[model samples]
Target: MAAGSRRVRAARRRQRRLAKGTHDLTEVQWTALLSAWAGCAYCGAEDPSLQRDCVLPISRGGRYTLDNVVPACRSCNASKCNFEVTGWLRRKQLDEQDFLLRYAEIRATLVTDLDDLDDPRN
Candidate 1:
């Protein structure tokens, strides 16, 4: 295979590996969840039905890592299924710039050294 082809294959393999749902939260993820104060990271809604959502959907090769996730309410999370963060915000008629800024702030508070994409519990 050509060098470029090799790289593409490797990337595909990685994406396939990361597409599965781990259903396990790392310590870092736990910290992010707690730090969100059980509220939606996107809208600041204090919802008991909150869920950890992938900012970049898994189908798009988004890794299930600390940096790629945020706490979101069930409504927002379900509505955002497989949608890119910015796109979802736009579709919801939200201010993209403001949402991105808030996302940045939320991410900053939940930064972690753990970079594993697969479930750690596995």
Candidate 2:
């Protein structure tokens, strides 16, 4: 397809996602999430993006809902697999002290992480 056609198609997808109650993650959002986390939620380092990690996974059976997804670096996502948040967290041997520090730990973290992208920093 033509470049203009692709752009239009992409725009329609964005509009659809917006109407469906989710904001699509651009590469920038993924980058911001990783940078803000400063590496792994499990282990702090530059993490692979092979798979996305969810703050809340779906096989606890969640909606594609905004309150649930997180941009997990690959290994963390793999560690998480398909279990409930706490279950996967435990499997990775993350203690409550550290596990409790994940984005889900504070509702405000969610707001801050996402909102920062659109905010103008001086």
Can you give the TM-score per candidate against the true fold? 0.63, 0.54
lDDT of 2 by residue, 32-64 (tens): 555556666655546555345656544344434
lDDT values of the candidates?
A: 0.72, 0.60
Q: Candidate 1, clashing residue pairs?
A: none
Deviation of model 2 at 60, angstroms? 3.2
Quick one: best lDDT, which candidate?
A: 1
The candidate that wins on TM-score is: 1
Clashing pairs for predicted structure model 2, backbone only: 53-72, 58-61
CA-RMSD of model 1: 10.0
